[model samples]
Target: MSITTYGLQHIKKETQHLSQEQLSELLLRLARYKKENKELLAYLLFEAHDEAAFIEKVKGEAGFMFSQLSALSYHAAKGMRKILRLLSKYTKFAGSKEVEIELLLSFCVNYLEYADRRTTYKPIRLILTRQVEKVRGLIGKLHEDLQFDYLESYNNLLDDAEKKLIWFKKNDYQL
Candidate 1:
């Protein structure tokens, strides 16, 4: 049989009664048992108070992830997938649409700049296109000013990708 979950108020009250040491131990225990808990704890401790800094930190991480992509055609797509997964995890922890859009934009930029479509598989192109579409949808949900800002960035990314594609086609898909 499943146990009924306590209400948030009840849980908060119970948590407030714990001593500092007890709270620390409880947090450690929660983090140890689940990856999501660990990420949540990390955000609480390190990222939540400074969203802009956190976004910059994750963008740098994404750049590093992109840099690690293999030159070999076969491994490149797998590496891109791994980078995308890490970005998703970071975006989830940030818990903001702005962060999500920023990370996805970084992914698109990296995919265009670093990924060799001529050498890599078609699935990687599909993955990048899907993320671009997702980012567009997310931009529509933001406030008008923010949406305009992000839409401009999104357009630039697409333009760069298109330029690269045209160059690749003219060059007979050699990058």
Candidate 2:
């Protein structure tokens, strides 16, 4: 026999019938089962009210991670991928395109500053390229004025990458 599952609307309707104490208990129980769920709940409770502060805090953590990246090419690539995972999680929690773009831009800028530019590590290079493309796509979804502002920073990032990394081609990333 197979168990039944409900859609979000059904779940919401059911949840609405529960008392406040029961709802809180349910949420706490759910959070106790998964680390990500707990983090998301914590963000919603504390950091969601002050998005700017949250973004700055995340950026600072990313910066510290970048600074501590391994010297070896392969290890550095792994470290970068880990950082990207962290950013991806926070972006999901924030659920804002602007926040996503800002975090990604911070990743790219930190990469250019601290990564080994001369290494022929394909994964490392691909990480930056993929992130640049992602940022460009996200920027397109914003308002025209915001797009223009982000484009300036994006263009500057590409220019800086072109100058610093031998493998980076500005033409490929051009708007």
Candidate 3:
């Protein structure tokens, strides 16, 4: 026999009459059991109000992670992947196209600076390319004014990446 599970709608209806204290207790219980629940609860309670500050805080985290990356190519690739995953998670929590674009731009800029040459590490290049495409898609969904602003930033990153690629090729550091 299969057991039926309560959907979120059902759960919401069941808890609709919960007092503030009851709600708080429920949240604490959920948070205690799962890391994602804790993060979502923290976002709803704290970071949901001030989006700009939340974006800045996440950007700071990405920068800190970047600063601590291993110099070895394999380790650095792993660190960059972790930073991207964290930034993506925070972007989901923010639920804002602007936050997503800003976080991506921050990530791409740092990535271009650190991982300039695709020949050095293909995975890093793949990560950078994927993020740039994501940024492009996101920019199109924003309002026209914000679209222009983000497109300019995205173009600049691409320009810099191209220049670096050319320079690296001329220097012949790697094939």
Candidate 4:
């Protein structure tokens, strides 16, 4: 990610709204991490903490406790945990009932891939793509640029992933 110079102050200045810079940084981080074959644990501690902090910030802003988050976030996270368990993976990560990048990625790569792309589907796909960096948007909501840049990258990744899914399907190739 190009978020080389971000911190709490930067976080406090941005918004949940979408912008270019935010998206670049988020997508960069994601692509680099994925290309490097790095697990979420491979990211810096501050980054993870920053992410969790943003989630907490959103929850705080919405005054929505973990128990009150959308069923999508809750159930999907649980489903991801089941996958992790089946994979025999072990980590000291947070509870599986809340938002986590692994769960979000799994949801994107697994379930969301099946939906046909169209006018009605963009928003949810956008939400899924943005979900990973939604923390950045949340932080950005509290920061300077006002609109969140992360959304741009998230949307692009979602779009790219969607396109690849379509192509692969047409070609009878498995993702």
Candidate 5:
């Protein structure tokens, strides 16, 4: 037997028929099943109203996570990955490229602050490089004005990373 899956339009139409109380109950039940669903719902209901505040909150959390990172390269890499996961989830909840770019930039800055760039750990280095590439890609998709602003910050970040980290090369991530 196969379960039926409806398109988003069909689901929206069906939901229009639901009474307010019924809709509320359905959303609550849906949120109960998965952690991601719950987080998305909470973001929509609360943080969606003030995106800047939400972004700042996520940045603060990332900073705190960075501060708690282990001095050992392997452990620090693991912790940095965890922070990336958190930023990825919150970016999904925001559903905006600009938010994604901002969160990613903030992550890179936090990583630079707490990370020991002198280490030969590939994973830790790759994490920063990957996020910089992601931010660079996303910046291109934005309006030209926005692109100019983010690109300045992106260049600054790359300059700092190159100066501080042995693994990062300015030529590798250039636009």
Candidate 6:
């Protein structure tokens, strides 16, 4: 599946109709991990924040679910948790010291395919613009991985998401 397909309007409509319990159950399932399945937490958080109501319902629960997983430091899940926290504030999201969205997504993608790709969530496949790789390079260009650079990385991600708004429009996102 190429990463450029935007089922944006359709996805928006579909997610809006989902009941809170239905959404919660999906997220709960996403949050689960087996004895050694490490990629589970990150992928679950990716799908939980499509709408504000959904975000309002699951952010805390997602937080709690990940807090336990955080202890395991499943390579990328902690980053996923922070990414979701930001996405949950959509519309209200003003941007911050952001990790590039592309990098964050790439991190998740790498984790997904680490063991198997077919079992991972599908939207990730849609984010195929190599945005993560470009962002990784940008960070490398700065050569500034510091104690506070982590905080600034989130802002960079926010800037990237806002840029996507303009990008999607130019690509003829009428729906």
lDDT of 1: 0.81
User: Ten-residue segment with the worst summed lDDT in candidate 2?
Assistant: 166-175
**Candidate 3 has what TM-score?**
0.86
Provide the clash count, candidate 6. Answer: 15
List all candidate RMSDs to the true structure.
5.1, 1.1, 4.9, 18.7, 1.1, 16.7
Winning candidate number (TM-score): 2
Q: Candidate 1, after superposition: displacement of residue 162 in Å? A: 0.9
Off by over 4 Å in 4: 1-93, 96-99, 135-162, 165-175
Best by lDDT: 2
What lDDT tens digits, residue by residue, belong to model 5 across residues 37-72?
A: 999999999889999999999999999999999999
RMSD, model 2, all Cα superposed? Answer: 1.1
Q: Model 4 over residues 102-163: C-alpha lDDT tens digits?
A: 33433344434333443243444444444445433343444344234334533545555647
TM-score of 5: 0.95
Please report, in order, the local distance difference test score of every candidate based on alpha carbons: 0.81, 0.95, 0.80, 0.42, 0.92, 0.41
Worst 10 residues of 4 by lDDT: 166-175
Model 4 vs. true fold: TM: 0.24
lDDT, candidate 6, 44-133, per-residue tens? 355334433444434444344434433233333444545444443431331222323333443433333331223233333334223344
Clash pairs, candidate 5, are: none
User: What TM-score, over all chains together, does every model reach?
Assistant: 0.82, 0.96, 0.86, 0.24, 0.95, 0.23
- How do the residues 1-175 of candidate 1 rate in per-residue lDDT, one tens digit apiece? 9999999999999999999999989889889999888888989897799998888888898898888888876688788888888888888887789999999998888888888856546677677777877888899889998998887788777777778764322122111
Q: Which portions of model 2 miss their true places by more than 4 Å?
A: none
lDDT of 3: 0.80
Which wins on TM-score, candidate 1 or candidate 4? 1
Better of 1 and 6 by TM-score: 1
